[model samples]
Target: MRNILVVNGSVSGDASVSRALVEVAVQRLLGINPDASVTHRDLSHGAVPHLTPATVAGVRAVANTDHELSTQALSDELIAELQAADVVVIGAPMHNFSIPSSLRAWFDHVLRRRVTFSYSEAGPKGLLTSKRRHMRSFDPPW
Candidate 1:
């Protein structure tokens, strides 16, 4: 892959096992493709905000107010990031049997209805077809 997007969703910071796994995976990928460029998104520090009415409106492309418009722009930016990536690596540790809130919020921002996916007569089809996704979920005993 030419462009790799790495997402860290661990709240435990440097102590996260999932993050370590992602690091190893990234290093292996880099060994395979020495010329590939990597981008990182750390979700532990609130880089992506929780879903709100304004953000929802933005994702739906019906933004009106200034807050909604701004959120829409942010969503567009995230979508562009996803679109530009050749491979996506996600480090997500299982918390309460689900993903972290920040990662969920990241999904809320990028997963647009007509933009990223669409419903067809058969089933839902993702618009991003060629990108590869690698995810590591380390479920530690809590």
Candidate 2:
């Protein structure tokens, strides 16, 4: 069975257009693959903590170190979820021409060094090759 991860970044929750788009996408995906499993991470409802100096330090720290932080736990969970997914769908609303803070925070946790990507002498390269679809919502008259 394929694993599909859906991330909702809209502050308007269920009423947001981004979420509606995600729903449609999910329906289409399930229609294609009946055995696919869907998992959701509602960023607005469960806001990801903003990265701090301590969080960065925790990320760089050695595993099983004396200094254990909550950030490490959170990052581990987020990264694991991303790594396990065969497909990812992100629903983000554009605010001031940028992504929502919650969505950005979610990225921060999942986009870990040596986890989601790695740097070589050439350049930074992504480790994740999972199919990703980004759905953006805008103020609309359409």
Candidate 3:
């Protein structure tokens, strides 16, 4: 069975065009793979904590010593979702000509050292092998 991770980054909730597109994409995936399981991470509703010094410390602790820090649980959960997913879909709307802060926070949580990536002799390498699909919606100027 395929495991799909859908990340909703639009703060407009149900009114977001990006989210509506995501719904359509998810439905199509479900139609194609009836046994597929989906995990939804709604960033607008429950935004990931911003990467502060404490959060950085937590990431370092996990990478270096495998120790649990204050934000360890949340980070672990996010990493686990990424690791378990066979496909990942991100819905991000262009806000101020860039991605939303909530989506950036989500990326901060997932892009951890020794979790989503690691430093090799050449450079940093992505650990995730899952297929990723990104959907962006923009409002036209009136």
Kindly report which residue stretches of model 2 are placed more than 4 angstroms away from their true locations once superposed: 61-68, 130-142
Q: 1-142 in candidate 3: lDDT tens per residue?
A: 3998899878885678887778877777799998999999999866587777546666444543233365676777888898998878888789899898888888877788876899999999897855554454434322
Compared with the true structure, what per-residue lDDT tens digits does model 2 show for residues 95-122? 8899988898898778777878889999
Please give the distance, in angstroms, between residue 52's alpha carbon in candidate 3 and its true position after superposition. 1.5
* lDDT, candidates in the order shown: 0.85, 0.78, 0.77
- Candidate ranking under lDDT, highest first, comes to 1, 2, 3
Tell me the RMSD of model 1 versus the true structure.
Answer: 3.3
Between which residue pairs do clashes occur in model 2?
none
lDDT by residue for model 1 (24-61), tens? 77887899999999999889989789877656798777
List TM-scores for all candidates, in order.
0.90, 0.83, 0.82
lDDT, model 3, position 134 = 47
Worst 10 residues of 3 by lDDT: 133-142
Candidate 3: Cα lDDT at 55: 62
